[model samples]
Target: MEKQSRHIFSKVFTNAVLIIFSLSCIFPLIWMFYSSLKEKRVFNADVVGLPSNPTLKNYKRILENPDYHIFDSMFNSLRTTFLSVLLIILCGFIVGYIIARVQFKLNRVIYFVFLLGMLIPIHSLLVPIYIVFKNAGLTDKWYTLIIPYVAFGLPIAIFLVEGFVKGIPVALEEAAAIDGSSFSRTLFSIILPVTKPILTTIAIIQTFACWNEFSFALVLLSETRLQTVPLAMKQFSGQFSSDYPKIMAAMLLTMSPIIIMYFVFSKQIIKGMVAGAVKG
Candidate 1:
């Protein structure tokens, strides 16, 4: 009975802690939503309490405004993110397979070269990258944004996919090879099917990274027409102050897709992470 009481007490303590943590994390989202809906007067007067009269004006204004081009910015963000992730996944799959399965003398060196990227601060290379992009006549172009995103994102993607590839048994690939399947054929047909979960996880992570990337995009892209959501949203902030409600509304719009994606593939992502952890 004493032990039972102890376990019950522990459970209660854990529950209380978790409830507090959950509320703390979610409070921001609640506040953002409330601020977005509240009248400007109420928001300025008292931010903690509920709004006296909630209005959908901010959202409506956003949708109705043609000049702001929020949708265009969103489209640009989506386009760049998709293209970057696709290249990363394809290249990552090939390189990841080689490192995970094939044993070559230089394999470790090659893996370390990829791993080296993560250690270097991206800010450190900004100047060199800008010079190279300028000489290549690629700055201010869509490819400029996509290239840097893929380059920076490759290391993590390779690491994730390589870990997933290790979890796959060698016998399957060997059997396919013995039957006269080419290396490329075996990898695409046999290996890729089994690595789908990890691939999804890698793709999703790359998507989020590319979507939210600011520093590189800010420096690389100059045209107002080419601005992404993160960059375009800066317009809402003035030199001295910011429009809190409109900004929050825009943030909610920008963040909604990623949140939805997480909800949809969260199970696969968790499974992939667990599998990769064990394999790596």
Candidate 2:
């Protein structure tokens, strides 16, 4: 009876902690949603508090603009994120597999260099990158976004995949090879199948990062028609002031897709994380 009581107490304690943590993450989102229903011109000290009355005017205003190109920017961000993540996953898997499976002299050096890329702030490289892109005629296009996103995403993707790859047994590859399965077949059929969880993690992380990135997007992309959601949201900001409610509405719109994705893949992401961490 005492042991059962202790187990219940422990479970309750853990639940309490998780509830607090979840609330912390969720509160800002709740606030943002509340603000979105407010009038754009109204600024109140109690803005974050519950709204006494709600209006969908802000949402309607944005949606009513036929030539605003909000959906186009959304598609632009989505297309770039999709292509970048696909390339990151493919190349990251290949690189991670080779590094984790094969022995080579330069392996450690190469891995360290990848890590170093993460250490350098993106802002630090913006000027040089802008100049290079300008010279290469890559600025103000989807490729401009795709190229940088892939580069930024690769290091972390490689790291996540490497960790998961370390957990996969070497004997499985050997056994598949002995049965006349080619390396590519063994990789796609055997290797990638086992790494779905980790892949999901990488995909989610890269998608969010690329979607929210604003600094480089602001500097590199000048064509209004080609702007992303992050850049488009800046339309609400003027030289002297900003619209809080409309900004909130825009933010809610921007985050809605990712929030839905999280709920959809929360289980797989959790499972993959646990498996990767425990096995690796």
| TM-score, per-candidate, Cα-based | 0.91, 0.91
**Residue 242 accuracy (lDDT) in model 1:** 73
Show model 1 residue runs off by greater than 4 Å: none
lDDT of 2 at 127: 96
Poorest 10 consecutive residues by lDDT, candidate 2: 40-49
- Candidate 2 clashing pairs, residues 3+ apart or interchain: none
Q: Report per-prediction Cα RMSD to one decimal.
A: 2.1, 2.2
- Model 2 bad stretches (over 4 Å): 1-10, 41-45, 66-68
Error of 2 at 84 (Å): 0.7
Per-residue CA lDDT of candidate 2, range 100-129, in tens?
A: 888899998898888887889888999999
Per-residue lDDT for 265 in model 2? 76
